[model samples]
Target: MTSAPITAADAAVTSDTITMPLEDVIDPDEFTPRLLALLSNALVYRESHELRRQFKLGTNEWRVISALSMRPGMSATEVCEFLGMNKAVVSRSVTRLQLRALIVLSDGPRGSRPLYLTRAGAEMHDRMLPVSLRGQEIITEGLGATEVAALNEVLRGMLARIRSDAALQGAPGSPSQYPID
Candidate 1:
């Protein structure tokens, strides 16, 4: 999808009815949602690239590992809930991690299912946390502490709103279920 390009200066106009160059005024019918989608896609791509490079993990893999790190020995169901991921995706990630010797499965004493991270998994998590935090710090360094806090709050609110709306619309999944573009 293409949008009429609006320069930064053009976007700063104050008047509601300011006359823009022909190239700046995109057709509302065709441009608005597409432009929004383009921005969303770009952000997701950039974030994913950073995650892949810094952590050596895809977005899905990171989600699974992060969830396990937070609460070791959680069942797949627990992971799905905690990560807001689909069962299949979590299952695949777990399988991959197990194959990579990063996680392990055991039987509970009472014969119930067991879920957990291996020592290697814990070590990997510890190793990756600093890198992830550094990436986050880099991304937010331009913003003041208060601005960063506000940004977090705003993003959380938006996520909550979207989740609620999805639920009301009878969507099959939660906010995090959708792949990032």
Candidate 2:
């Protein structure tokens, strides 16, 4: 089973570039990968805007907070590895969060410090949780529980496949990071 190719004019989002005409290659509406990227981008854009307005938080900072919320005691290196984010960016966010008194670090051997959320950080995370959940609810409004579960199953499988592919191809450069699982 294959989807028909859609032209630039037909899909309006087949290609990112505006100067060149997008060929009837892949219809983002029908293509799973393109659809996934578009949806992820939409979610990130929304998060970036809302977080900045609501919490004065950048996407990077929120990402770090999110990782820590799920897995406490993660070092910056561990966060970078898990989130596939740039070390420098994560470092800066960590510093900012620390400055805000939202996060604290535990001393470790050889200057390796594990990150932990402060009382205020946890409170902020609690507040932010509803926002994220609401965004998810909005996106899944028409879908049944079973359908959403199936979609997650598919996405998880895709993530696993991509990780395996990346392992085979070798790690990407520091400038490019893998998707956070």
Candidate 3:
């Protein structure tokens, strides 16, 4: 059966006919996506912050360390590709991690390229991995396995759509579809 139309008064009240909570009263279309994004980002930031504190490393350094943990020796370009980051940012992060003795860079076959991660980097990653897993568990506590899978599929589809639209807009000679930033 189709749902009934929502009136302003119905939207403002709970099932018990009492005024809904402030969060519940907000317009869904106006605030749901923003709220969800902010909440997701906040959780990520909090976990990253805790990891940094435990490992004595910044977010960028942690990313480099984590990348190296997966593979001991990766070039800058490889790391950038894995992390979806630009070269300049990766270079700066690598330099800082190297200076801190968390990672060591050795010359590679191609023009003095560096392969990264020291013993300290591995240790930090090991220490923080459990915490990260715990954080993830907490975030997904109420979600059933099926629900989690469904959410993942939905989010992936949304990301693909967004990326496809962006690419189409950025293609040259496409009538300048979107106003360039």
Candidate 4:
């Protein structure tokens, strides 16, 4: 990475332009994979904050509602796995939703209790559905149907690669098999 030319006009600049922003120095649309992931997470944070403010639901709570709405009945561990969220956060959210009368617990195989959304929870999901749908539309505004499908396929591949790495890390002797450079 090279620094911009320094001159009298640039002397007052204190920003680390040399290495601070790779996207800004290049075409803004061309982003590194790291930056793309960061931006995707940041967008989720922003959306979650807005939804929390508007609907009186925390991000995790909203996610629980959303997940149950889709999956009908899922354990906290299952929700955590599906959402790639921390177990504690999902557990707390499950408790909160239950206390709020938004969800109900039901017995499952092996004495497990899976969560299911109540009528109120379904109503909330109905109301918040537009927010996510519109957000998706905005995110893929300029893309054709084919392009959107391709993007989804590529994202799935990327997620699979990361999931494989996570699975490997959990296996015994895996780290020793592939030492970090």
Candidate 5:
């Protein structure tokens, strides 16, 4: 069965039928995609703010550290490809991380160097884990385990479908990079 068109007329009003103007009745919450995107940005901003205050790390740096923690010894280009970030941003974050002594570079063939987290970096990542997990807990506080699992499954399926369609279309520029599974 199809759902009714969401219109201003559906809103509650007096029995006399005075209603809100149509232009003013566009509820943002009804747009699932935009709502989800806004929610994602808000959550990211909150977590990033706390991470910076606690660890003096920007979102880019934390992304690099998190990526390296999972897959150690990734070259800068590999990091960019893996993270879907441009070369310049990743390079700058890598430089900052190196300056902070959180990452070390090891020489490879043809002047290529792979980045590895220093002992300090690993320790810092260990400390940051719980903070990230706690942010997740806060967001999912009202969701049951089954609901959480279903949400995850739906999101993953959507991502996979979009990625597959993009690949097939081969739309402009470089190919898109996906999150590590």
Candidate 6:
């Protein structure tokens, strides 16, 4: 493995970049992964904040809702795989949705059962769809369609590459085993 050398602009004393919280000691610009992680955190925070206020659900729970809406008969284990989230997190979200009558579980394998959104759950998902779509638009507000497509392509490739990392193979809820591209 090789590490990319940091550019001078990343840590030059004369540069006027905002490297706050880490100062010149570390630059977020020096790390593409850090920048991407920050962007994801920002987007999830914004959406989750609004979701909690509007529907009493956080982004993780919302992800579960979205997953079930897209593929109604998925088991909790399948949902974990689909979302690349922990089993415990998915299980908690499943329990919360069930308690609220938003979804119901049907028989399947002894431990992993299929789950489906009830009529109310479907309604909630339909109502929440706009929030998710709006978040996407906001993030790409200035980008043209072509640029947006390019950005999406890059993101997909990056995700596929990261998911294919040998260290992640067979990890809990690992998507690494799947053919991403």
* lDDT string, candidate 4, 120-173, tens digits: 999988887776676688679999999998988887777666557866668543
Model 1 lDDT-worst window of ten: 172-181
Estimate, for each residue in 27-142, the C-alpha lDDT of model 2 and write its tens digit. 65899878878888988888888888999987899889989999999999989988988899999999999999999999988898999999999998987777677679878899
Question: What local lDDT does model 1 show for residue 67?
Answer: 77
Q: Estimate the TM-score for candidate 6.
A: 0.78
- Each model's number of backbone clashes? 0, 0, 0, 0, 0, 0
120-161 in candidate 3: lDDT tens per residue? 777777887786677568767899999888877887676666
lDDT of 4: 0.77
- Give the clashing residue pairs of candidate 2, or none: none
TM-score of each: 0.65, 0.78, 0.68, 0.72, 0.77, 0.78
Q: What lDDT would each prediction earn against the true structure? A: 0.73, 0.85, 0.72, 0.77, 0.83, 0.83
Q: Give residue 73's lDDT in candidate 5 (0 to 100).
A: 88
In the range 1-181, model 6's lDDT, one tens digit per residue, is 9988999766677567655565445565888889878988988889999899999988888899999988989998778788877789998998888998999999877776889999999999998888788889987999999999999899888777767664456544356333343
Off by over 4 Å in 1: 1-56, 109-112, 174-181
Candidate 1, 12-82: lDDT as tens digits: 66667556577656686688567757755765566568767875666677667777777877888778877
Candidate 6 yields a Cα-based lDDT of 0.83
Q: In the order shown, what is each candidate's alpha-carbon RMSD?
A: 10.2, 10.0, 12.8, 9.1, 10.7, 10.4
Q: Arrange candidates, best TM-score first.
A: 2, 6, 5, 4, 3, 1
Q: Residues 36-112, candidate 5, lDDT per residue (tens digit)?
A: 78987887787788889999887788889988999998999988888878889999999999999999999988898
